[model samples]
Target: MKTKILTMTIYKKLTTKIHFFKMKIGINNNNAGIIIFLSVFFVSFNTALSVTKDSITYVKPNEYHGLLLNDTSNSIEKYEIQRLNYSTLYDILNTRNELFGMSLGLNGHYNNFLSYGAIDNNIELGINGRSLTNYYNGKYNLENYSPEFFERIEILKGSDAAVLSGHPNNTFLNFQEIIYNTKIPFTRLWYAQEGGSFISADAIFSQNFSKGWNFTFGFKKMDDRLAFDNMSTDYWNLRFILRYNIDSTSSLSISDNFTNNKTITSGGSDPEQSLNMYNPINSSPYYGKIQMRNFRHDLNVTYSKKMNFFNITNTTYLTSDINERALPRFDESDTLGNTSNTETQIGNRINLDFTFDNIEFKAGSNINTFNSEGTNFFTEYSGVNWNLYSRAELKFTKSTSISGGINYGDDSKNGFIGFGERLEHRLNENSSIYLDHSFISKNGLIYSNDLENEKTNLFIAGLNLETIKIEGYYRIVNSPIFNRLVNEFYTEQYNISDYQAFGGSASYREQVLTDLFDKNDKIDLRLQTRINVIVGNDELKNYYPLFTFNAGLNYMLMINKSELNIGFKAGLLDSKTAPRFIPISNSYITTTNNVGIQTTGLNIYSIMKLGNAFVKIEWENLLNANYYNVAYYPERGQIVKLSVVWSFFD
Candidate 1:
């Protein structure tokens, strides 16, 4: 596959740059104990992946479900779920970067990232589980993250789409999926620098002091400085969970979650056409900051009973909050565009699970009410929206299964309808084939009712193959989010009552060698292609085709006493679409169609151990390709970064 080719390139570069060096550090008994403890904790966390379908069947299989599923990768705690994980980041680098208009591309300014999907442990969580943001909006971008704190990043693809609402495609959720059964808390401090610099800290603490009581707490903080002038952020997240087990048959739990962010704009100026345009203050260089806050609390109760040949689990939960954003007005360009927003969401969830001899059953429902509105601190907007989601699953046999579900919701702006089904057949231990189908309808979206409900149908099929040294997948999907309008450039088109998209991707992986330190050394390959055949009445006639091929390989070798991890990644992309940022009102309204491959990206990185610290050097986008990203039309040129990770605890 493509990823393998990329890996080959990485290996060649690594071998050429570094010669074998000998250095030795003594490992005492204390170091052995620590390594053992960390290893056990990591293995336990991985057990979540092998929990046997008989225990829980709702989870979609494979890494496409999220980063948590890359079973073939040597990194025990890090799995690249398709395109969702950081490991995949290297895969993308090894391939070509393509542009498909704004709707589909390697890098666009908008939020199509939100459209992908989530995995287990990640859940359908949004800002307070009320409102969801697009990846381009800085919503889902991983930004700067430490690979150590994460057990896995899961990416659910195709069939898993049934578990989501208010968004399209599968879901992507961070596992943070640490081993909860462990007695001790784990803390990790990580730092990384790309076009910017970032520092992060994460801690997951859990305890079971008695037979029936347990406590768990999670905390995370991330601070990153973007390359763009004044573009930097500080983000914080915390969650507390308490549980009471009633004699192993039932449980009650209460949880609280909080997230806050502060943003500073430094180097770049506001867009020339924005409200800030032509402001007298624009003459001077400046910097400004914005702050956003969100909080959520939930209470849940669960009951399980086993009798005769059947087992059942019932869970109920209450949630509150939706989506809102706020920012302070300060510097020059324009204080008028300064904004503030506050919103609340209240809702309930009920889920059920049933198991029998050859089949398992599951069902769930969700209802949320959003009281949301925001202001530029100038104009006031207020309204409410109602949202709902339901699901059901059925297992036919150990090797084959099918599941289906529907979701419906409404907000002041739009009405939603979604339907989907999945079919899976395991051919053997190493191979399987699967199919997925989905449909969705939307009306009165984005504060417009003149728009009609848009309807879409999606079909997907894929095969998975595994071997002693290699495992991977190949799949494709055909579906559209909204259909086309009868007339082009019609006023109705501007209204955007509905839209549609249909496309698919194919990927693969293989292990080139093993026994580095006599441990497994590896390579990965991937190829993906997607297209949006968009047909909306009026002027919006967008047909976007995007193709990406990526490959990468990393080898770890212990020469003397120090360890060295070297890798290189590269890729190529072909994009066939317009720029992503033209306002909906002006999309296709202009005759100038910006179409091309857009740009490409490449990165080569090496990690070398020098005594107590590790040095990392990376050359990103080595060619310094000229590219235009979707939002705000930011220019992305080549960047070089260097950083270090020190073992302070050890």
Candidate 2:
């Protein structure tokens, strides 16, 4: 089987049922530690051969389900936070970038990064157990807000994300809110800049106004330019919360999360990579000129109660999102046209936890009512969806445990039921082995009630050792949905296959440098590698990169009232297919088997800290290697960014 990117040359404008996805709700709140959902998104252009005459109309994957069943990236700790100032979510994720079939691409844009070779937006985003996913295009563009806006940013990756809702093919990124208990008002402020241009500012306040009552607020803003021509982004986020403690075990909280953003793009690098033959290059036309403005707001009210034997939580939320787009009609003049879309999601979630001797159980339900009113390019759509799920974990011995559960969901015209199980056996304090299996179903941007639901059978196995960890997975899909990622490109295609993917990852950690200097805790190092092979049908055979690798090393020293830290890291991707972005539609297109060369990029970066306050100076694409992960629309070049945080807490 030969995997290839298929693209269409002729750019077309066709308005149809928009791709929409439900939100993922992670109810455990703070304990919802970071998760890495590994997924591969395959885009179709139109042919198994070279791209036809540098086209525009292309592909999309409709919230494809991804992988990373039981693996999680490194957790963000206070120490790491001190080493790496909390800025954008992309900044935080850079600490552990893409892993195993994951692609972090389309830089210099909004919150859109990290994709599995699929088309469209493949990741879903949420906050405090509520979804931030948009119904218009089934994406939670990772733009605007900074990770500092939340107390914890949990990455819900892969099948493990079943506890939440979204396209099964999507990894859910949920930001957990900060809950304060200080009687005296406290505040924290942060600011950062690069190349003398202000890039970020943040403010947070917390206070306990009265007994059993607490309030919190947070704000963040940023404006900056990237290496791309006619490319820039401005954004801000605001959050407010009020909580009342009914008693030690019960409380009620209300919150509002609002975000707004604007981005200007020049489309992407010409798939042909040709220098403008016209004189006065500056006067030449911009083949792609696109601008997007959007905003999101969520209002939530939550109540929680704790008992000796059980814990319960119920939350009702309303989320509204609006998007405005201006782009050319694919005409010679590239004159711009305007389109807008809006969505509102009203949802309620009830979750419970119970504890018994050697056993733990959980059950939950979610109800969502969604409505979308379209504009120039979209059609109207409205629907209701609900989900019910339950699970139990039993510890048979100190070294052995088993867990399994099932989920059921339905809407007016479609429904699905799935189940998953896991078993773990501890070999020793430093080692263990486990197995995971699940029979699941995923729905992409649904348009017709008569369309058949997609189903998947997934299997995974892994082992954990004191200094090394490894995992592997196998998956099969029936009737997978794929789309061309070009601007205004839409297609309803079902491609079925068996045993589509098989892959694994390995990780290693040590303190080699520190031990050499008799400072065991002063230096830390890590190395990891992953590989994925797509042995799917002819259409998706060899399109995905075959391998990925990453490494990092850091050193720390402390002095009186001051500290120092320095580190360097690198990531690499190798493959023959490249992914490109289209600014107007916020979508991606592939060379579509049009790649004339095998493209590879090795990006090296450095980080440093001085004083007690954390500051970061990074050399992105330090090697300046030609690569696609950096995106192709605006043309990628080496960039050095310096950002620092000024805080009152110090």
Against the hidden reference, what TM-scores do the models get? 0.62, 0.78
Per-residue alpha-carbon lDDT of model 2 for 211-249, expressed as tens digits?
A: 677777877666655444556666767888887766667
TM-score, prediction 2: 0.78
Q: Point to the candidate with the largest lDDT.
A: 2
Task: List CA RMSD, all candidates.
Answer: 12.1, 16.2
Off by over 4 Å in 1: 1-160, 163-179, 194-197, 203-218, 243-253, 264-335, 374-397, 408-415, 444-447, 467-502, 513-545, 558-564, 576-595, 607-617, 628-650
Cα error of candidate 2 at position 404, Å: 1.3
For each candidate in the order shown, give its overall lDDT on alpha carbons: 0.40, 0.56
Error of 2 at 257 (Å): 1.6
- Per-residue lDDT for 512-615 in model 1, tens only? 56673565344444344443344442223433434445555666666565767777666554554333332111122222234457445666777777654566
Worst 10 residues of 1 by lDDT: 19-28
